[model samples]
Target: MSLSLVLLFLNFFTPQFNEAGQAKLEKMVKDRDALTAQWKASESQKSGIFGNRTKKDMIETNEWLERIIKKDNLIMDELRMIGDIETITATQTGDDYKAIAFKQEKDVQALKRAVAERDKQLKEKLSERRTFEWISLILFLISLGLGFVVYKKVIKP
Candidate 1:
């Protein structure tokens, strides 16, 4: 029946609705029943010269109103807690992402520095090799000129 389906929905979803515990849900149901009984009793009274309600009835109604207000405040507190949890989770995730980005940037900088040092060493070695080659070429030319001078002066005489 539709009534059974409604009961099922309340049973399954009421706790999740406010994220309240089972004890809190039971307390809410008791408060709801008490308020309903008070409402029905007040409605059945005949309107008279006294305007329908005694002072005691007014006091009882005031108490029920206060109880309802307390329940609403509790629900609000639970909602605020859920919001705080979500905010914390978002902040933590953002921090983790920033850390990963920072680590990757550091790694890239380190690799760039290593490559620059390697290039500098290679350039130094290449310059040293070129100097050696120039010195060897000059020494060979000087030895050939000395050999020609010795042959003309000593061997021809």
Candidate 2:
């Protein structure tokens, strides 16, 4: 039953894990697209006297690159965690299978012992019944012989 529950949990959790990873990836893609659009818009702007706009764009670009790197690292870490979870689950499931197999073997042995005991009891009962039947037959034959002898002596005299 614990094994079944574990299987059920895995069935539910794996899809959720996949969905979370996919959502993160989608968010990253959206961020990248937004950054690209901003870069393009800034490129189309004219150079002012101070050129302050160009400097601001460079700073924003640098920040975007850093954010992208952080997100990638986060995603890689999540992937590694998922891999570790899979390894643990596999090991646990294998242990559960072995336990179930061992339990079944024990149950089988117990059933065989029960069947052997029942057969022995049945044979003993049959032997007792046969003995009773033989005794009854011998008693009946003795009585019949005695009756015949008494009838012949009294009737003939």
Best by lDDT: 2
Q: In order, what lDDT does every prediction score?
A: 0.71, 0.77
The parts of candidate 2 lying over 4 Å away from their true place are 1-3, 18-78
RMSD of each: 11.8, 5.8
TM-score of each: 0.60, 0.57
How close to the true structure is residue 52 of candidate 1, measured as C-alpha lDDT? 69
**Per-residue lDDT for 84-128 in model 1, tens only?**
655655675566668768988999999999999999999999999
Q: Single out the weakest 10-residue window by summed lDDT for candidate 1.
A: 14-23
Per-residue lDDT tens digits for candidate 2, residues 51-146, read 545666667666666766776677677677767777776777788789889999999999999999999999999999999999999988998898
- In terms of TM-score, the best-performing candidate is 1
Off by over 4 Å in 1: 1-51, 143-157
